[model samples]
Target chain A: SQQGEEDPQALSIQEGENATMNCSYKTSINNLQWYRQNSGRGLVHLILIRSNEREKHSGRLRVTLDTSKKSSSLLITASRAADTASYFCATEGPTDSWGKLQFGAGTQVVVTP
Target chain B: DVKVTQSSRYLVKRTGEKVFLECVQDMDHENMFWYRQDPGLGLRLIYFSYDVKMKEKGDIPEGYSVSREKKERFSLILESASTNQTSMYLCASSLWAGRPNEQFFGPGTRLTVL
Candidate 1:
C-alpha cells in the first residue's frame, strides 16, 4: 500500500515561474526522497532528505521534511519547459529493510513556454 | 556514472504466455528492484534483491517471480502472463546494502498483454 499521497494531482505553470508540490505520509519514516519522470521514460532521482534534516537544496530544487506532521514538500525555482514531468515522493517506512520505498500517487507538472 | 539497462523497450505477449524481463546494472550495486507502473498507481514494487541469489517479495509479488543470479543482473519472470499484468515495467539499482540510497532506473519496458 502507498504510505504517501502527493497533493495537487496536476499543476500547470509558465516557464520561469516557481512550482511547489506537497506530499503527506501516514507513518514515520527514515527518509524521504523525490523523483522525476518524463513521459514514456523512467524516473530520475531528484533529491533525498533525511528525517533529521529540516531542509536541503540542490541548484534550483529545494526539499523540506517535517517529521512532526509526517509531510514533505518539493519546490522548483525558475522552472523550465524541460522541467515538465511527473514528480513522485517516496518514503522509506520505519523498518530495517531500508531499500524499500513506498511511492506516492505523484504530481504532474506541466511547464508551458 | 550509474547506468541501468533493460533488455527491451517494448514487448507484446499473449495471455498465459511466459515472459522474462532482464535488468543489468554497471555500478555493481548491492540492491535491485522491479516495479510496475499503471495509470493511477504511481509505482508499485514487485520484487527486490539485495545480493546475488537472494530475493524478497515486495508489496505485489503474486503472479510474478524474480531471479538474481549475479550481482549485476536481476530478472523478473512472469510464470503466466495475464491481461491484467500489462504495465510499464521499471528496473532500478542502488548502492549500499539496505540503504535508501539514490537509485538509477533504466528506460522502462512497456509490456502489453493481449
Candidate 2:
C-alpha cells in the first residue's frame, strides 16, 4: 500500500497563476520530499522539509507541512508552462533506514499559455 | 552531480520471454532502487539494494527478481514477461538515506510486453 496520497488528481490553469497541491500521509515520517516529472522522463527533486520544519521555500515553490494533520502542501507561485508536470510527494518513514521513499499517487498540473 | 543511467530507454518484449533491465549509478551511492510507474498506481517499488550482493523485496515483488553483483550495477529480471508487466521502469540511487539524502533518478525505461 502507498504511504502517501495526493488530492486533486488533476488541475488546469493559465500561465502566471498559482497552483497548489496537497499530500497526506499515514505514518510518522522523518522527512517529506517533493519531486517533479516532465512527460516521459525521470523525476527531479524539488524541495524537502524535515518533520521539525514547518515551511520551506525554493525559488518560486513553497511547501508547508503540518505534523498535527499529517499533511503537506506544495504551492507554485507565478506558474508557467514549463511548470506543467506531474508533482509527487514522498515520505521517509521512521523505520525506513535505506531511504526507500513511499510516494503518493501524484497531482498533474497543467499551466496553459 | 550524481548520474544514474538505465540500459535502454525503450524496449519491446513478448510474453513468456525472459527480460533483463540494467541500471548503473556513478556516484558510488550505497543504495539503489527500482520502481514501476503506471497511470493510476503511481510509482511502486519492486526491489532495492543497499550493497553488492544484498537485496530486499519491496511492495510489489511478485514475478520479479533483482541482482546486484557489483556496487555500481543493479539488474531487474522478469522471468517471463506478461502483458500486464508493461510500464515505465525507473531506477534511483542515493547515498545512505536520511537527512539531506536526495535520490538521483535515471531517465527511465519504457518496456512493452506483447
Candidate 3:
C-alpha cells in the first residue's frame, strides 16, 4: 500500500523559477526521503530528512518535514530545463521492516526554457 | 562508485511462462529489494532480502517470488507470467537494514507479458 500521497499531481514552471511540492503520509515515519526520476529510468536519491530534523538542504534542494502534521515539502530553487522530471516522496515508517519504503504516486514537474 | 545492474533493459514473455529478472550490486550491500512500478502506482515492493538465502515478502508478493543465492545477486521469479505482471521492474541495494542509508537502484527492466 502507498503510505504517502503527493499534492499537485503536476506542475509547470519557467526556468529560474522555484518549484515546490508537498507530500503527506499516514503514519509516523522514521525518515522521509525524496527521489527524482527521469523518463523511463530508475530513481535517484535527492535528499533525506529524519523524523527528528525539521529541515535539510543539499545544493538547491530543500526538504522540510513536520511529524506533527505527517507531511513533508520539497523546494527546488532556480529550476532548470534539465530539472524537468518526476519527483517522488518515500516514507520509512518506524515499524516498517527491513528498511522498506512506501512511495507516493509522485509529482511530475516540467520546467520550460 | 556504487553500481547496480539488471540483466535486461527490456524483455518480452508469453503468459504462463516462467520468467526470471536478475539484479546484481557491486557494493556488496547486505540488503536488496525488488519493486514493480506502474502508471499511477509509484512503486510497490514485491520482495526483499536482508542476507544471502534470507527472503521476506513485501506489500505485494502474490504471483512473485525471489532468490538471493549470492550476496551480490538477487533474482525475482514469476511462476506464471500474466499480462498484469507487465511493468517496469526495479532492483535496489542498500548497506544495511534499519538504517538511514539510501538505496542504489539499477536502470530497471521493462517487461512485457503477452
Candidate 4:
C-alpha cells in the first residue's frame, strides 16, 4: 500500500520559473525522500530529509517536512527545460525493515522553454 | 559508480505466456526490490530480497514471484502473463537495511501483454 499521496498531479511552467509540489502521507514516517525520473528512465535520487529536520536545501531544490501534518513539500527554483520530469516523494515507514520505501502517485512537471 | 541494469527496455508477450525480467546491480547492495508502475497507481512493490535466496512478498505480489540466486541479481517472474499485467517494471537496490536508506533504480522495462 502507498503511504504518501502527492498533490497537483501535473504542473506546467515556463523556464526560469519556480515549481512546487506537495505530498501527504497517512502514517508516521522515519524519513522522506524526493526523486526525479525522466521519460522512460529510472529514478534519480534528489534529496532526503529526516523526521527531525524541518527544512533542507540542495542547489536549486528545497524540501520542507512537517511531521505534525505528515506532509512534505518540494520546491524547485529557476526551472529549466531540462527539468521536465516526474517527481516522486517516497517515505520510509516506521518499521524495522529499512530499505522499504512507499512512493506517492508523483507529480509530473513540464518545463517549457 | 553504482549502476543497475535491466534485461530489456521494452517487451511484448502474449497472454498466458511465462515472462522473466532480470535485474543486475553492480554496487553489491544487500537489498533489492521489484515494482510495477501504472498510470494512476504510481509504483507498487511486487517483491524484494534481502539476501541471496531470500525473498519477501510486497504489497502486490499475487501475480508475481521473484528469484535472487545471487547477491547482484534479482529476477521477477510472471507465472502466466495477462493483459492487465502490461505496465512499467522497475528494479531497485539499496545498501542498508532500515529507514532513510537511499535506493538506486534501473531503467524500467515496459511490458505489454497482448
By DockQ, the best candidate is 4
Q: Could you list the iRMS of every candidate?
A: 1.4, 1.3, 0.9, 1.2
- After TM-score superposition, the amount by which residue A105's alpha carbon in candidate 3 deviates from its true location, in angstroms, is 0.7
Per-model DockQ: 0.72, 0.74, 0.78, 0.81
- Give TM-scores for every candidate, taking all chains together and pairing residue i with residue i: 0.98, 0.98, 0.99, 0.98
What is the TM-score (0 to 1) of chain A in model 2? 0.98
Q: Write the per-residue lDDT of candidate 1 for residues B1-114, one digit (tens) a residue.
A: 899999999999999999999999999899999999998799999999989999999999999999999999999999999999999999999896555588889999999999
State the lDDT of candidate 4 residue by residue for B6-75, as single tens digits: 9999999999999999999999899999999998788899999999999989899998899999999999
TM-score of chain B of 3: 0.98
Cα lDDT over the full model 2: 0.94
Taking all chains together, the TM-score of candidate 2 against the true structure is 0.98
> Model 1 lDDT vs. the true structure?
0.93
For model 2, residues B3-75, the per-residue Cα lDDT tens digits are 9999999999999999999999998999999999999788999999999999999999999999999999999
lDDT of 4 by residue, A7-99 (tens): 899999999999999999989888999999999899999999999999999999999999999999999999999999999999997783748
Compared with the real two-chain complex, what DockQ does model 3 have? 0.78
Instruction: Tell me the lDDT of model 4 at A48.
Output: 94
DockQ ranking, best first: 4, 3, 2, 1
C-alpha RMSD between model 4 and the true structure: 0.9
Q: Clashing pairs in model 2?
A: none
> Candidate 4: misplaced stretches above 4 Å?
none
Instruction: Predict model 3's lDDT versus the native.
Output: 0.94
